[model samples]
Target: MNWVLLIIAGIFEVAFAACLGKAKETTGNEMISWYVGFLICLAISMYLLVKVTQELPIGTAYAVWTGIGAVGTVLVGIFVFKEPASFWRLFFLLTLITSIIGLKFVSN
Candidate 1:
């Protein structure tokens, strides 16, 4: 359950990052809307993270959260924002994913 909430929190982290990216590409009202979305997602993400940290190890939870955020944001950059998906980028992403999984397995 805690792990599930942690994953959701990480997803919100990704959402906030996506909102920031969108905000960068817009102006005026659109930019403000994206910023608002960012704030909302940020709040939810932090809330979930704090909740889960009560049960899960802080180091593991934080690494997994940030790992999910990093992986998700990079994928969003590639697919949604049309950023480069170079070989090295994908290679490192795979490594990050592996490390996250490894942490989950080693943790309670």
Candidate 2:
């Protein structure tokens, strides 16, 4: 249950981050929607993060949450924004994913 919450929070983190990126690209009325989306996702993500942290270790929970967010945001940046997709970047991304999984396995 908590794990599910954490995962959901992480997904929200991704959404908020993507919204931020899109907001930066927009202007006036176009930006408003992205900003609103960013705020909504940010709030939900934080709420879920706080809820999960009540039971999970803070360091572990934070790392995993940010890990998921980082991976998701990078993928979005790559696919949507067409950011750099060098071999090294992909390698490190995979490593981050592995570390996140390891943290989950080691936790209660």
Clashes of each: 0, 0
Across residues 9-107, which tens digit of lDDT does each residue of candidate 1 receive?
Answer: 999999999999999999999999999999999999999999999999999999999999999999999999999999999999999999999999999
Residue 93, model 2: Cα distance from true site in angstroms: 0.3
Residue ranges of candidate 1 with Cα displaced over 4 Å: none
TM-score of 2: 0.97
TM-score of each: 0.99, 0.97
The per-model lDDT (C-alpha) reads 0.99, 0.98
* Superposition error at 86 for model 2 (Å): 0.6
- Local accuracy of candidate 2 as per-residue lDDT tens digits, 21-102: 9999999998999999999999999999999999999999999999999999999999999999999999999999999999
- In model 2, which runs have C-alpha deviations exceeding 4 angstroms? none
Q: Which candidate is the best by lDDT?
A: 1
Candidate 2, residue 47: the lDDT equals: 100
lDDT of 2: 0.98
